[model samples]
Target: MRFSDFALGLGVAVFGIAVLLHVRTFPEIPGMQYGPAFFPGLIGAAFLICGVALVVGSVVRGAALTERFAERPAWFGDRLAVWRAVGVVLSVVAYALVSPVLGFLLTVALLTAGLLLLMGVRWVVVVPLMVLLPLFLHYGFAQGLRVPLPRGPLELLLF
Candidate 1:
């Protein structure tokens, strides 16, 4: 559904302000010029500025406060688009629910392969991506970033 520029701007401004307030609660590092909150605060400030600009621009252009939701086309008007969106969402949800049981490698590989196939990708290309991508991401997160991912029976045997 479409929203009026003014409504969008107001919503964005409120979200930005909320982000700013939330980020302010992050603990500061001792003797650091830039702390944990620095990046988030910067993003919040940018959002706030952009939101204010949008609000002012909309007002200057004499835009309405709201748009007619019923005038918009049905969300599922395009069958392929709707199906693709649903497929992606379902794949991610399945990955989340099944990952702990099936492990990250198997679950993500299957999810990637399934999504690529859904998007009409060739099995030749899908096969390599399904295998390599999950391994690469696992290594990056588990080794490089030191973040632990869920490990199932297969992962336990291998790693």
Candidate 2:
């Protein structure tokens, strides 16, 4: 659905405030400034700031809300765009459903490759992205974030 900048900004700002308020109720760990809510709170604050900025910018520019929208191409009217969007959504849903059986790395790699292919990306570029992106994400979440991702038989054997 389309929304004016003012309306969108207001909605985002409200959402951010709600997030901030909800996160405040989480239990804080002693001797640590960061906790489960830390990242969420930061994101909420960023959203609030960006929303306010958009609202102010729109007002200051003296541009009508409809004028901003008129500059954009017709997304829903395009057949290719609709197909691309559907493909992306299906890929994501398939990844989620298959991840437990195939493991995060394998499932994500396949999904990425499929998406890249759908976007008409070259095999050379798609190949590296499919291989590297999953590994990087796995390392980042498993090691950096200390959050373990699901492991299938293949992942169990390799790592």
Candidate 3:
């Protein structure tokens, strides 16, 4: 469930570098100083900086750098862990099977609430998340990214 700081930092640094390099291929906009790559490139740069900081900090802290790359998670021995894992997998499968028909908003709302309850989150938390999280995702994917999410009767009423 976890990796040593050195290992984790190395992976993050490599991922950050990859992102930065990949974003370099995005074509510039003719009239704009900031193109399609602007935000993503900034994010990649931030990642690179953070990753380097993590690596340096870990090294400076005198952590043996020999910490186990991975340790058996405590949950592995717990009986309910299997049910929890199964619940998560079932949620994903259910989402894939029903998302188009239910629409992104409804499907995500249901999935969020179900998973939260499965993980023993209280109703006070789950209720608001069920509503707000779906709307946030809809805005991010549908409005911000301009991706076309399937529309159901509820979406027709709302959007």
Per-prediction backbone clash count: 0, 0, 0
How does each model score on lDDT? 0.85, 0.85, 0.86
Instruction: Give the local distance difference test score of model 3.
Output: 0.86
Q: Tens digit of lDDT per residue, candidate 2, span 5-65?
A: 7777777888899999999998899999999899999999998998887777778877536
lDDT of 1 at 21: 99
Candidate 3 lDDT, tens digit per residue, 1-159?
787777778788888889989989999999999998999888888888878887787889876365776677888888778678988999989988998899888898988998899889999999999999989988999999999998877799899
Model 1 misplaced regions, further than 4 Å = 3-68, 71-75
- lDDT of the structure predicted as candidate 2: 0.85
TM-score of 1: 0.56
Q: What TM-score against the true fold does each predicted structure earn? A: 0.56, 0.52, 0.54
As for candidate 1, its clashing pairs are none
lDDT of 1 by residue, 1-159 (tens): 566677777778888899999998999999997998999998998888888987888888876554431244476698877888899899989988999899988899989998999888999999999999999999999889988898887688889
Best to worst by TM-score, what's the order? Answer: 1, 3, 2
Look at candidate 3 and tell me the lDDT of residue 31.
Answer: 91
Candidate 1 RMSD to the correct structure: 6.3
Query: CA lDDT of 40 in candidate 1?
Result: 92
Ranking by lDDT: 3, 1, 2
